[model samples]
Target: MRVKRYVVNALPEAVSMIRSELGKDAVILNTKEIRVGGFMGMFSKKKMEVIAAIESNQANTPAQPQRKASPQANEALEQILHTVQRTASAVMEPPIVTPAEKQTGRVEQEQSIIDEIRDLRQYMVKLSKQQGDHTALSEQLYELKEHLLEQEVEMQWVERLIQAIIDKQTEQKSEFTKEQIWQLAAEQLEDWLRPYGGIGISSAVRVVHFVGPTGVGKTTTIAKLAAEQTIKQGRKVGFITSDTYRIAAVDQLRTYANILNVPLEVVFSPMDLPRAFKQLEERELIYMDTAGRNFRSELHVSEVNSLLHTSEDSETVLVLSLTGKTKDMAAVADHFSKYGVRKVLFTKLDETSVYGAIFNLIMNFEMYPTYLASGQTVPDDIDRFQIETYIQHLLGSSSR
Candidate 1:
């Protein structure tokens, strides 16, 4: 392999340079943001460090007629396919044993390889899809890819989903309709998201703190959950709000409390949590709503973490919205994750047709999604995270 590194302001620039210098067979092995040429940890330039490589023989071979696909895409696809093929070959094939070798040893060795290959095959499928080309996908696959991209799914994931479907088509060697293509995509998505599903607020927990950025419906979500517990389950529920900064925040929550006949407490700071908890001690469940700040900042996340201090069994649920930018939500989730926030609740589902942000956040952070709130209706619109339902929302009604 011929490997080369390039540092450029963005990925597109790096791709242009790689295609011109390394030929159309090169693929990007890795890329990351890096800072260069700054003094005293200040004024550093942010640039992308891209590592690309091509097979030695491919490098030496004469250029062939270019296809319709862009050189940059072809180059990327070639390198990725090369790496996957090499890795899969290495894993799928075991070392040869001599015929004269011990029969007992040979049997054991073959059995071990068989078991390993079974597991490795599944992993290899994922790796293949993750690194495969997207340019030459079939008509059905291309349509599915375009729909997912329109839904705001990340590019890497889109490639993986399409590649998996392509692999299936190749294996079956049959034509597929748009509906069939979408079914394959849904299956792949479910397989990837299965491990992160079926978890929500624990009934055994005494306190559930809701935290996130401003205007993500944290206050209303709290009310919804409180109503669910109070009216549906007949569990005594109470509300605590440190969201004094938002005008009418207390009143909005108090209105829900009055409807449910649940007690409410107001805490301005971390020091007042003990008194607030004492006031709501009779309640079976307490849903504390924290003041939503710029949680993308580590300092703000820490401030919320301080308020989360308690001896009672508790869990912090990060509230996010589908309306927010994927990158910005990722920033907030990243910061909160550092403080050990593992559970997430997404709101405003009805407001946005784009549901890929939910998938992106859950997959990227390994955060367990508890609930999805679609509308303003208390407890009615919010439902426990279901993989089938979510995939339906994500894939929509038509594959075309």
Candidate 2:
């Protein structure tokens, strides 16, 4: 085999390079991300590293017709084994390093490359086993895959969901219609989400703290929840805000407090939390709003976490916005999850059509969803999260 490696900006670029140099018979042995250039590890550019190879006899052959069926499992296994052996051989070679390369963290880069190669080998094997006769799947299954992917659901979750439907088809010896496919998807999603579903803020907890990144509508969500406690439940509600970083945030919550006739206390730091709680001691339930910072940074998350110290029983809700990117929301969730913040509330639901981020965050972080705030209307727009409703939003209309 003739093996070659190309580093390019994307997979498409690498494909073009391989096609021209390695011929149509060339198969991708591995592909991974690598950082190319940087100043002391501060501003590196991301690049893709693709390794491809072709059989010696076929390297000079004319392009052949593309096959209609997926490659046989045995052929895939043989290719993966060959690649693994090649990788092992490469790893055993002696290092040929220069002084500049040593200063550039060449050793670390080499280790990263080795790790990527190992991951690629395992993934190739998984594909060989899991993706038998990929083209033979029903159109409904393909549509389901496309829909979930478009919704930004994680790839592994989508695969497992589709696999479940495929297993059902095998047992029944029949293909599912569009409606049946969507129904099965709903059932599967509900089953996965059931354990983390239907958990609202605890009534027994005297205080509820809302924390999240800036611009996620934390203060607005607090107002909504507080209105529900004060108006509907008739509980003596109080507000304590540590969001003095932004003058408008405190003013916003204070305005809501005034309208609802709930007393509002402002605390500048953790030390002031005691005084604020003492003032609201007579209240049945106190809602604390923390300053929304870039919680994606661990320092900011820890800074907010410090303000949560209290003797009263309290639960913290990691408030997220539907309009935010799923990856950024996951980062915020990951930071709060470390501090034992398991309950979540999603806001700005009406602003975005996508609902997969809610499901992704809940499933990935094992979080209990508390409420979904869909509109600007206080109390009326926010409701206790229902799995059925969320799944419906996630799947959308199935009339097609």
Candidate 3:
């Protein structure tokens, strides 16, 4: 294989270089936009970079008939030539040439060239088709990348998905339609977002905290999960609130606790966490409702971390609202991650037409959403993270 990378002013220039250097047989492997001639991040010139490669002809022999140009060669063409040569050799035998019949021998050589060139032209036609197919597949990849990006998938992940889709496309000879790309991209989506499902805890998670920015419906999500655990799953579930800063927040959770026949502990500070835990220690599942913090404040996140750290055995579910901007979600998730968030829970799935923020957070933080809360109803609104649902959201087949 011959591979080369060209950095040029424009895509057409790169293409011209590839064709001149590697001949018409060359194929583009990848292309990227780059910057050049920059001075301390000032006035940088944009450039196009392309990587092109061509495979050497594998079937050429010294005894082969001459042609102005060799067979349009690639791995596919090589295989075709191998089959044709084998079939011709097996079906016929060579005849001896006499001195008197030298002219006939010359005629035979010319005929051989004609026959080989005919077969070579067929291979060239096949090569053209292969190239066209690849170009079409590349366009499909670009579309898939755009779809993911439009849904708010981060840059690195979008590229990763494109590469994965390319591999799947190359594995099959069939043409790649949008549906095929969607299926391949969905498979990739599920693969990367691993360790996903229902909270990754049951009675085992002694202390859990649901923390996020304000208005993310964190309290409601907690109630939904608590209800499912205690009512449906029949596991002992309790609530602890560090959200005493908001008077209504405490009462809201208290109301939920009363309806579910569970305990709700309101903590004034980190010092009160131990006493709260002691009260709820007997419960199988203890959910800590932390104050909705301002991501802009490091002090707030530190306070949250301090309160949650009271118990060594604890998990934090960074609740994010799908309706929020992806930038905000990422920043808030990053800020809260200092407290050691093990999983994520996305709320308000029904509120947004864009779901890329969820995937953006997942890949950016290497964390998967454990559950999704689509509405205000307890338990019913909460769903265990389903890959198919997420895929549908990405493909724009389901509600975003």
Candidate 4:
């Protein structure tokens, strides 16, 4: 391998210089700008410095004893030396000519640079083909180009995150059987919910508290669960909503409670939560829907925490929307994790086109999904946590 650096006034000139010196097999390693002192101390030029390397197959070939007076090899060496010297001299001097002459020179320089790049690309392709590493080299070149294009520092952080995920998936690929995939997903969910322990339904009546960020369908999800348990399992269901902050939110849950003929309690504070639970003691399943507040707001989170901590056995399912960015979803999960959230309920699966956020959440935060609500239908729209179904949905294999 031979490494060379060329500093010139423009990219085209630097590229041409590199090609002329390196015989069109050069691989660009790096490029940067530097200030060059010109004729007088008062004048300086911004030059582009390009570092390139060339790999020679001849370097690895076995040397054989040769007869003296091989004029062809000597002639080739002299030609190479002449090209290097000429390119170096050209790089050292700035072009000084008439405007028309300079324009023509620039056009020719650009065409030559393009030709050199094409030749180098072809050489790389031939090398890759000979070594049977075309795919690998192509992928490496693509990654190099991507890195070069990403000039933002934040992009480097994003790249690291993507790399970490790819590394984790690659490491676990061998252990990932269809059954193991399900088990792994379930275990991840169990881990996320382990802090809150199992869902408690000990008393004659059990109260499950659902609290999370706004627009996560906490009220509708609670209604769906209550309806499923009451209508399908024949369990007595009671509904309580603390969404008095919005009249429309209160009306929506009240309408659902009325249709099911289950008593609904509307509460507003931490003190109201206990009273509401006490009033629904006769019911077999009690679902408490709290007001959805901004998880990003410290004051709102603190308020929700005060209200939710009223019951030790209450299962606070952190409802997150599936239609959000991965980072935003993770932020939401992290923010709600502080409120003693045990399980996660991912909603609005039908609204999103991709499940990258879900994959990221499960892989990064290890959050277990207790339920996935896909549609707006009461009871029918909700389903128990099934990793296969979630995967199928994410992969666009499911009709549902």
Q: Model 2, poorest ten-residue lDDT window?
A: 62-71
Q: Which residue ranges in model 4 land beyond 4 Å of their true spot?
A: 1-91, 94-205, 397-400
Candidate that scores best on lDDT: 2
Q: For residue 344, what is the lDDT in candidate 4?
A: 78
Give the range of the ten consecutive residues with the poorest summed lDDT in model 3. 58-67
Worst 10 residues of 1 by lDDT: 124-133
TM-score of each: 0.68, 0.69, 0.63, 0.57
Tens-digit lDDT track for model 4 on 309-345? 6543556667888765566667777777766554678
- Worst 10-residue lDDT window for candidate 4 reads 144-153
The CA lDDT of each predicted structure is: 0.81, 0.83, 0.73, 0.62
Error of 1 at 209 (Å): 0.3
Output the TM-score of candidate 2.
Answer: 0.69
Q: In candidate 2, what are the lDDT values of residues 129-223, reduced to their tens digit?
A: 34533544666777888888888999989989999998998899987899999999999999999998867889899999999999888888888
RMSD, each candidate, Å?
Answer: 19.7, 14.6, 19.7, 13.3
Off by over 4 Å in 2: 1-134
Clashing pairs in 4: 189-368
How do the residues 88-165 of candidate 3 rate in per-residue lDDT, one tens digit apiece? 342243456677676657577646755764565456546654554344445566677777778877888887777777
For 322-352, candidate 1 gives per-residue lDDT tens digits of 9999889999999999889999999999898
